[model samples]
Target chain A: MKVLPYFVILPLAGSFLVIFIDSVLKDRKVRDTVADILANVIMLTLFILTLTLFGQSCSYFVGGWRPPFGINFLLDGLSHLMLVAVNLIALLSGIFSINYMSQYTARRHYWALFLLMLTGMNGVLLSGDFFNLFVFLEIASVASYALVGFGTEAEELEASFKYMVMGAVASSLVLMAVAVLYSRFGILNMSYISAAMPGESFDWLLKFSLFLFITAFSIKGALVPFHAWLPDAHPSAPAPVSAMLSGVLIETIGIYALTRVIFNVFSYKSILLANLGVISMMVGVLLALGQTDIKRLLAYSSISQVGYIVLGLGLGTPLGIFGALFHLINHSIFKSLLFLNSGSVFYRLKTRDLNSMGGLNKVMPVTGATSLVASLSISGLPPFNGFFSKLIIIIACVQSGHPVLAVWAVIGSVLTLAYFMKVQKLAFFGKLKEINKEIKESPFFMSASVIILAALCLATSFILLPGVRNKILTPAVNAVLNPTNYRMMVYIK
Target chain B: MKREEKNRAPTTELNGMSEIVKTVCNWIAGFIFLFGCYITAYGHLTPGGGFAGGVILAASFILIVLSFGKDKISPLLPRKRAEMIEAAGGLIFIFTVWTAIYAGASFCGNFIFKKWSCANFKLLSAGFIPLLNIAIALKVMAGLFLVFFVLSITRVILEGEKLKMVKEE
Candidate 1:
């Protein structure tokens, strides 16, 4: 419990250390190796450390100052789930980057920025107050802006600029919301704010701040209305960076932060969340179906999938919350897997256009097979992780007397299947293109990262069983179900 | 604006500003730096803490760069060295945070000079606050310098591009 600070410290230290090593070392090879090894080690350590907090919850106060006087890192079931997901995806992305980033220069700076992104994510996950959350969100956002333009090409720079502009807008909105909340409640600690919220009736200032919070986070999560930046930004980054941005970054800074604010801080429920979720689901898939670029297609799908999570969380039922949290993890695994697979394809072919690829499975069996698993899982095929979560979401929808919404959810699943099937057929199943005849499998690390994530895609479904659900999913659901308990986080230690 | 001016010889005229600017910068930069250090050192007791002081420190370096040019500053504080200092500043801050644990307090707890009387207004009385301030100042100073250096070089590149466009025209 006392080691909570390490979640923030380790990645931050690694980020700085990589910069130091890059500046000091004369040889590019040694510096790249040192940076790569240092980043992966820190990520792996954080991942393993998160695994230790599976069933326990605690709060650690920074500088030994008790809240609401000092900043704290709260590790409850919700944060535990987010921490595990973020660190696991970050480790895999780091491994994938080791091989994927060689074509780019300044590899050490890549590692430094990548680790800084992780630091921001970890800090965001652990932060106990609104201000700390905003700070961490900015850290992650700024690092990601640089990374999206890491290629320094024209398109990448333009995409980064667009993303930065939108991100800054979202950040300012978030700050405004935090200021509103602080001004109204006279507190910054989420628990303190939540403790005070129930005593007063809904005020106009509170309503305005809540509105800002929803809009800002929806933008970060790349829901339908604010999703213009995602397609450009996701494809422009280096592949590992794309994986992190789509699979982890949006979920943490966007959805997770929104959830904490809404469910834990305000404990308010509205039909608007569910409606927006449905819109994003339909619009995202519709947009994705027309894309020829592999990464862009996946980016659109991320928006649609996030819609499912929001819809579930919006239902405010235990089953709905469980489904949302489950799908959130499942999406992180398979989405990152799919992105890494696309990276592998780009690695071998030097092109992201799906039409240019054909019979790739014959040349890169590992990439093809993992890509297939991820695609199927994402499309909600039976026995894969996505199927269970999506099914749970539908069932919860119907049980909540929204059978029409459940049908719409099913329609969304079918559409997801349709596009991915198009991807698998056009890119991997046709005759090998003449230019791609000499293509080979991706490097070991890249392939290994995808294979591991693909296996997780299948393995994670087992958590849906009764015994496993008791240990993992139940606590998270309970955490969502009872916002009052979150107020105790500040009082506990 | 002429091609010849664009490709001027590598001498004093090409490298730096006028003698008046250089003289004024030389006279003022050191005092600004000293004031920044004073602010950082006494940050815990004053309104101008690490961030304000650090901006002042960076302003001093930026003033020197503007007056004396890249060649003058590169020999003293190269970009690589500035980057290293920034990273070192961050590392030292983390080190201090962890050292508090080794000294038998929680992470970032005020382990150094914890037993000192808080009623006194002295330099070293605010144990780790000043240390944290110094670290922050170092990071902000170097980081700002690096940003300015990068922007300045980029402007030079833009100028070259503009010259090429003129030649093409």
Candidate 2:
């Protein structure tokens, strides 16, 4: 249905509408109400469409032309899953931002940029062509660069500049790869490339392109070595923006593209994928342990959590794929919740320095409690979503006969717990400082977003139940496990 | 400060030959600017694309500013307006893609309003590819121009203010 594209279109439209309304409308109340209602409505519509599209395979041929030639928008289980996660987080962030962004100048521009970011994420999820995906990725990246520099402080500018340079490099690499693919395959559509890849062996050009793609995607995903920009950039952005960056942007665009390239384009090789996975997992956690800034710590942790997803996907087993997808969803929820909690802390206390914050729990119950839940969830405590996903991944590693990898996974989890526990002790549990004595709870909208996300953090663990798991995770895993099916389904011209 | 001003007199006279070199560099820069425009216009059919073409044009404009000064560039295209034009160019690119969808094609799918299958002899018959190149050229030129212009102005303003302070002291 046309509704498929509207998932991206509506937010983009909302972005412009917010700008228009804010400029024309004089009253702050009217502007706020309009922006709030519009963003919520747009995200709700996307969430509904994602649900409606679930369990069904749909393709939108741009200009009604058939595939292998025309650009196509394919919605299978994987895209559907990512769509739900991205929009849900965007909705929560919009709710959080309603009050939070008021403290900043140019609230309208903030909303505009936020919606554009959502548009970019959704576009990346739904795109079926490489070039289209790159364009949308740039859209999201450029918007994020500006958002990261939104504060206009010296550190923020420095972070933004560094991020822009790295991100631009990544984008250029992706573009070059796409160019090579186009010249080699004589086609730009992914399905076309996948279909054409099997019978023929690619020369060094193709291999070099693959190397570039992997390097670029890994940089975007913030795997350990290429991760310098992340610590600075994530913490430098405004909190809601930080939440979105850490939550879904890396997963959907970076890991998702890498997975698509590995599984569909190049053919999955278990050993290579697994090696990358284990290295990223260990290295990410090791780096994360040294960070003291709250957001920077979470940023490192985001890289490590992404490693878990990759480790699962690289296992190339049904259970592994299921675990990876489940963990992907769970991470989006809790990580965003954690960042939102941090946003709240920044809101009331006016600083992100963890050393400056102490005993905030008594004063800001919603933030403290929600962040506690998020901390436990991220550390893989039981009954929360993270525990089940991590368990599935570790079990998958063991079942796949990589017990050593499983051990490493366990070590990573322990490190995760230790660091987050350190965060809890330092930021939320110590003696209340006189400087923070006057700290109050965040605004109502902000608290509401956190509470909703906290509930999701607990409730999503039930997605591991058999019925729900089969309905959601099975189709997605099937999409990856059977890339041939994807080709057959779309190339029906 | 007075001593530095006095020191400047001999240096300015001693560097008169360098100023002549700078003037020659400026004219060469202007010629390079025209060359870049030619490359951008023909990018779709050749090796260069909007991005490369835009950067080249911006570089040429920037060389002129470097050799001369911002005051000369400002009157031709005010810095603020150039920034606005960059944003507008980006918008135009997005709008063009969306317009294709509105016109019954997918986003960025080029729809020929009228198609003429010409014998392969005419460059004028290149269809929508030429238009796409032009749109990209405009966007890239504006974007790079704004970025360079902003950087140059900021340097001039900040350094000029510092020099003024030194003089006052």
Candidate 3:
């Protein structure tokens, strides 16, 4: 409980500390190494700390003020799960960036902004109040907006601008919803809102605010309807950044927050989430099929994969929820692996266009092999993590008597396989390009990061085992299923 | 007369605005800055806090920048120095929070006032609130000034090279 604040503190401190070091150090190479080492150390420490947090459910009130009067940091099943994912991804991404980020100037700024973004995500996960969540959301969003344009090229800047505009709209909606909720209940703590939700005249107002939340999260998540910025924004970001954004960020802020609000705070359910999920699934994959740019295709596939998670959760069954949570973790691992693979490719070749490359496996064996694992995993091939989660979701759908939706999901999975196979064939399998003979493998740090993620892609499928499921995924499922439990966990002294 | 005119701040490209405007800005900016300090100090008892006061402090500096142009102000408060100040402010805040652990209170818990009571309604009455406020004020002031300086210095070309590029396009 005492350690909760450090989750926010360490990263926040690391962010400025790097910037300070950057100014102090004269040698650019030494400065970059120090920043990289410092950032990775912080991330490693946090990831270990998160592992220690498993099976714990408690709340740490800031300044020792009790809830309803003071802000709190809630570490329950849901938060614990998110903390693990965010920290794990952050750690890997930081490691990957050691060599990858050296390509860009002001590499210290990248480390600083990256740490700041981690602080925001961690803050969002632990924050027990609505307003604090919004603040943290802005912190993460703004860092990402700056990072997207870190290249400072015209196209990168334009993409950053587009992302910023969409992000601003989403933020405004979030603020409006918070205002509406505050006006009605006069409280910003989610637990208090949940406890006080059974009143009369403000029910419609509550629904309106909930609508606003869904819309806001939809935009942030890049669901089909509000997804204009994602294809542009995600692809424009540096590969490690793209990995973080596509893999962890959308799920953390978009899916996790949306579910927490709807399931826990409001205790409400509608077919709306399901509808959005299905549409994003179909549309995202279909649009991805035509894309020549590898990163853009991966970005679209993220939307599609997020659709699966959302769809599973929207079913409102325990099995469905379990599948959703499982899929969430799996998606983070594989999608990040895929993006890092793309980054490695881009780092060596200086291009993201799939059409320009051929037979990359001959030279860049690590990237080729790991990306193959990632691609197969994402395509839901048997023996990998993605297959289990997709299978569970499809089965959960059928069991819940949504067979049509289950069929739609299967079709979505098949389409996912189709596109990934296309990615592999075009980018890795064919004859080597005439001009690509000089291309060497990515640096050690990049390959190691991707290899670790690829291994985790195989390893995470073990989560479906009964013992592991009981220990990890079940608690998270229970947390989602019982909204009232959130209040109880927070109030536990 | 020539010596007096020279003693007066030169109205070169570096020195901005009319003599009257520069004189008024120089005279008033100090008072505005003092007022901002007062707001920050009394934040615990007053409506205006660090953020509000910091903005005012930034406004005073910005006035100096407007009256005395970039060349005049940049030397006095360069971007590097401002950034350092901002970073120092943030470090001070984190240090203060960490101090709570040594003071045997929770993180961000009030250490000073809780340990030794001061008279109510005094500047030192609130436990570490003033310190936090001061830190925030420094950070915000430096941060905003840096932003203003950067923006003010930015040269957006709507003509010349950009127009030529547009024509080429």
Q: Best DockQ goes to which candidate? A: 1
**Residues B1-169, model 2: lDDT tens digits:** 1123312211111112358867797669878877787777777567886777778877877776666665566676665455445545555556665677767666556665334545453455555666666667766776688777645433211333242211110
lDDT ranking, best first: 1, 3, 2
Worst 10 residues of 3 chain A by lDDT: A198-207
Query: For every model in order, what is the number of clashing pairs?
Result: 0, 1, 0
A106-180 per-residue lDDT for model 2 (tens digits): 676677788898899888887888888899889888899889988765678789999999999999999999999
State the displacement of the C-alpha of residue A96, model 2, in Å, after optimal TM-score superposition: 1.0
lDDT of each: 0.89, 0.80, 0.88
Fnat of candidates, each listed? 0.60, 0.15, 0.33
Q: Which candidate is the best by lDDT?
A: 1
DockQ of each: 0.38, 0.11, 0.22
Q: Which ten residues in a row have the lowest lDDT in candidate 1 chain A?
A: A194-203
Error of 1 at B39 (Å): 2.1
Model with the higher DockQ, candidate 1 or 3: 1
* Order of models, best TM-score first: 1, 3, 2
lDDT of 2 at B138: 66
Better of 1 and 3 by TM-score: 1
